[model samples]
Target chain A: MDVDRLNLPSDGDGPVFKEPWEAEAFALALGLHERGLFTWTEWADALAEEIARAQGAGDPDQGDTYYQHWLAALERLVQAKGVVSETELTERRDAWERAAHSTPHGQPVILKP
Target chain B: MSHDNDDHGHDHRSSDNHWSELTLRVKALESLLVEKKLVEPAALDAFIDTYETKIGPRNGARVIARAWSDPAYKARLLTDASAAIAEFGYTGRQGEDMVVLENSAKVHNLVVCTLCSCYPWPVLGLPPVWYKAAPYRARAVREPRAVLAEFGVTLGGDVEVRVWDSTAELRYLVLPERPAGSEDLSETELGLLVTRDAMIGTGLALPVASLSKRGCP
Candidate 1:
């Protein structure tokens, strides 16, 4: 993975994935890119647009919310490329929330069919 | 995890709930993407592992320590940072274009990414939260003296302060002056004196006296 082309918020080590979920979001984007869903330039452009939009919405431009913007950009890109629909994403998210509530603390939240 | 939660029962639930939504969202996205055959679970694990276990400030500390003990290496570091750093096998990503700012008794170098958190990842690892926060980004260039003071780095009036702004194209690392009385220390021992904040120019390298007090032989 030529992560250099991503233009992600990073320090000396590489990309900064502060949490497990942040890393997952980053990998998802990379995975999609690897599968030819989008080019690195297109991904960069989408992330840039998301950051600009968030700034416009008074997001304070704090670094902690960086991954949130990354996630949003991924979502936007996947939908735009017809890889996944917004409706499916929304539905999946809701299902996850329901699964999480029903699952006990420390238990894995498995979405049941 | 269970033991710590038992000790701090009140704080546990909030921490769990805080990241729950974001965690679930990512899980949801991953599941959806995987179901669509767009992403693989193993690939995600590999990416996560790379960032989590590998790369950090220890790499930069080694570089700084070598420079301190070897003048020739220090010259190469200042002349061509990227190549010199590559010698340590720390080349990739944000560290492609590197600049080593040498700090001296006469001049102090501080680094910041005013636009965003662009750093030399091959060396330093992740930037601290404050380094990426709004206040440090805005004030690092405006009144670096005050910022340094806040970080407990009080510079004399005679010392010149230089602020280096890191970008996506170019990143800067401060080669902090070796503390006095460290002449006898080995290169590896000297590495222990190098702190992440020192390389970032927010603090100085640990003094030799402090090392001895910490019981280092």
Candidate 2:
């Protein structure tokens, strides 16, 4: 099937971002592709699997979740590649949350030293 | 780096819900990528920094200033925004099918993507959190006046408020009406007066005096 037929917002010309995180996610995905970490075909299949999973789990199927699925696929691919274990990923996430919560509003959130 | 899962138990608290889950997912992926040498932390910071500070509403400000200074350019901008904006090399993924909305004395324009968070990235770097949240999306279409008021924008009753719902295929950028006493200002000066919210139609460009007071050169 043609990827364009997927009709995802990110597929064509449209607003690039609705939030900073979204842009970060977009850049991360593009960066990964550039580094040869995953082929576009692999990326697409992973993303498709994620969206399919979400749909099966009752995701409304709106474009609102397009990026969420993208992020999930990224995580799955990286884990599958053995670049990082799920345990390490979770620990880093908790660390970030602690750091972010401690940071003041309007200030850039940084990981604590 | 090998992950020792036996010692560390999963923290269900961090991945239990929506926002938290998303944040953790992004953070985890970032750290993993960095550890694998697939991406540099500094490089990612630089990329995010470019969008956050270096390249942003300022680019759109220049476009608005040029349109204000040149009538023909304004016409071109309204007729075919993509080509006109590409004249300055602001063409990309989110800006391919660009539609320029001119804020007039009689008609005020506001943009939102009710279905999702679609926004012009070439000119405007990213959508603010409020623009992406459920409240703003639902209210912007249902109660634009209230939403605009929350943003400190009060349109006169006589001025028609036209809210444009951005979609995946097309995006809208508002060309805010030039402020009074800005006629004598240079194009570059006019650009300085334009704000990010002005192009989004949520706020107007600052006055020349205010711009000067804000230390804008």
Candidate 3:
């Protein structure tokens, strides 16, 4: 699925969804990362661990749905990793929203190109 | 050694101008957060992560694809859109009232969140980065024809592009006319041409191809 044109930067070249799994997996990792529950390293390890566990559990979907794994990985990484508290994360979100949408330059739309 | 590659020659003047004009308030708030140390850089990084990666095109694609296949459903979609979308299990907190407008020989529909970029969230998922900003919200209604031109879509006098303002309470979807020579395609196959932008009324569904060229994006 193409990203909505309205959602893109005014100067973005084009929307690209070259691979289907990319977006779902990205969203899962992002949701966990937003809460600050895992470091980049931990996020990687959690995904690998989830893959192993899914394989062991005889998951038929296999590698197709890393998003599912991503969600599961986040659920565990949050409690086990102890990177950030829920309340702390909420506070951060509130602050980010303040910063991200506060004014005309709050969030950088051209972050990706 | 310090090394940096500034490969892109994007107009910083324009980007900066746009950024300053639209995100000044957001930047101010971010500065305040930095002052207080409430949001860690890591947390902020993750926020962007979900924003771009997790909440993505699949959500919007599903809506556009569905509308292409079902006309009676599309009719209901325009009549009481939010309720009709519920049939496909697209209802949720994010999805508010959504209206699906069908484009035909006589009428064409385009949607913009003119007042503040409020959109049909449930069916489309999270709004895109551009949609929520100031320029698109303001210019889309005032100069829709010009804006469409920016996207390389032109309408003739035979067709009328009616611009609809999407709100939190009422949102709109454009049911693009089904392409020619696609009568034999499956539901999923036909869905491919239903681009996310088309559903949001920025463009038309990609025209279909003959049998040999089926499955082309």
Return the lDDT, model 1, position B198: 92
TM-scores of chain A in all candidate models:
0.83, 0.83, 0.43
* The best candidate in terms of DockQ: 1
Q: How does the DockQ of candidate 2 come out?
A: 0.15
Each prediction's whole-model lDDT (CA) = 0.80, 0.74, 0.56
lDDT comparison, 1 vs 3, better candidate: 1
- Name the TM-score of chain A in model 3: 0.43
True contacts kept of 2: 0.25
**Candidate 1 colliding pairs:** A11-B121, A12-B120, A12-B121, A12-B122, A12-B125, A13-B121, A13-B125
lDDT of 1 by residue, B1-217 (tens): 5684465655444224333778877887899889988888998888667656776899999999999988999999999999999999988542248999999999999999776566787898767667766567778899999888777799999999999987666789999989998999999889988988899998999888767776754
Evaluated with TM-score, which candidate comes out highest? 1
The regions of model 2 sitting more than 4 angstroms off are: A1-26, A30-113, B1-24, B27-46, B215-217
Candidate 3: which stretches are off by over 4 Å? Answer: A1-113, B1-55, B210-217
Q: How much lDDT does candidate 1 score? A: 0.80
Summing lDDT over every window of 10 consecutive residues in candidate 2 chain B, give the lowest-scoring window. Answer: B10-19
